[model samples]
Target: MSITTYGLQHIKKETQHLSQEQLSELLLRLARYKKENKELLAYLLFEAHDEAAFIEKVKGEAGFMFSQLSALSYHAAKGMRKILRLLSKYTKFAGSKEVEIELLLSFCVNYLEYADRRTTYKPIRLILTRQVEKVRGLIGKLHEDLQFDYLESYNNLLDDAEKKLIWFKKNDYQL
Candidate 1:
């Protein structure tokens, strides 16, 4: 049989009664048992108070992830997938649409700049296109000013990708 979950108020009250040491131990225990808990704890401790800094930190991480992509055609797509997964995890922890859009934009930029479509598989192109579409949808949900800002960035990314594609086609898909 499943146990009924306590209400948030009840849980908060119970948590407030714990001593500092007890709270620390409880947090450690929660983090140890689940990856999501660990990420949540990390955000609480390190990222939540400074969203802009956190976004910059994750963008740098994404750049590093992109840099690690293999030159070999076969491994490149797998590496891109791994980078995308890490970005998703970071975006989830940030818990903001702005962060999500920023990370996805970084992914698109990296995919265009670093990924060799001529050498890599078609699935990687599909993955990048899907993320671009997702980012567009997310931009529509933001406030008008923010949406305009992000839409401009999104357009630039697409333009760069298109330029690269045209160059690749003219060059007979050699990058």
Candidate 2:
């Protein structure tokens, strides 16, 4: 026999009459059991109000992670992947196209600076390319004014990446 599970709608209806204290207790219980629940609860309670500050805080985290990356190519690739995953998670929590674009731009800029040459590490290049495409898609969904602003930033990153690629090729550091 299969057991039926309560959907979120059902759960919401069941808890609709919960007092503030009851709600708080429920949240604490959920948070205690799962890391994602804790993060979502923290976002709803704290970071949901001030989006700009939340974006800045996440950007700071990405920068800190970047600063601590291993110099070895394999380790650095792993660190960059972790930073991207964290930034993506925070972007989901923010639920804002602007936050997503800003976080991506921050990530791409740092990535271009650190991982300039695709020949050095293909995975890093793949990560950078994927993020740039994501940024492009996101920019199109924003309002026209914000679209222009983000497109300019995205173009600049691409320009810099191209220049670096050319320079690296001329220097012949790697094939």
Model 1, residue 84: C-alpha shift (Å): 1.0
Candidate 1: give the clashing pairs: none
Off by more than 4 A, model 2: 1-3, 116-118, 167-175
Query: Pairs clashing in candidate 2?
Result: none
lDDT of each: 0.81, 0.80
TM-score quality measure for candidate 2? 0.86
Q: Each model's number of backbone clashes?
A: 0, 0
Residue-level lDDT of model 1, residues 100-126, one tens digit each, is 999999888888888885654667767
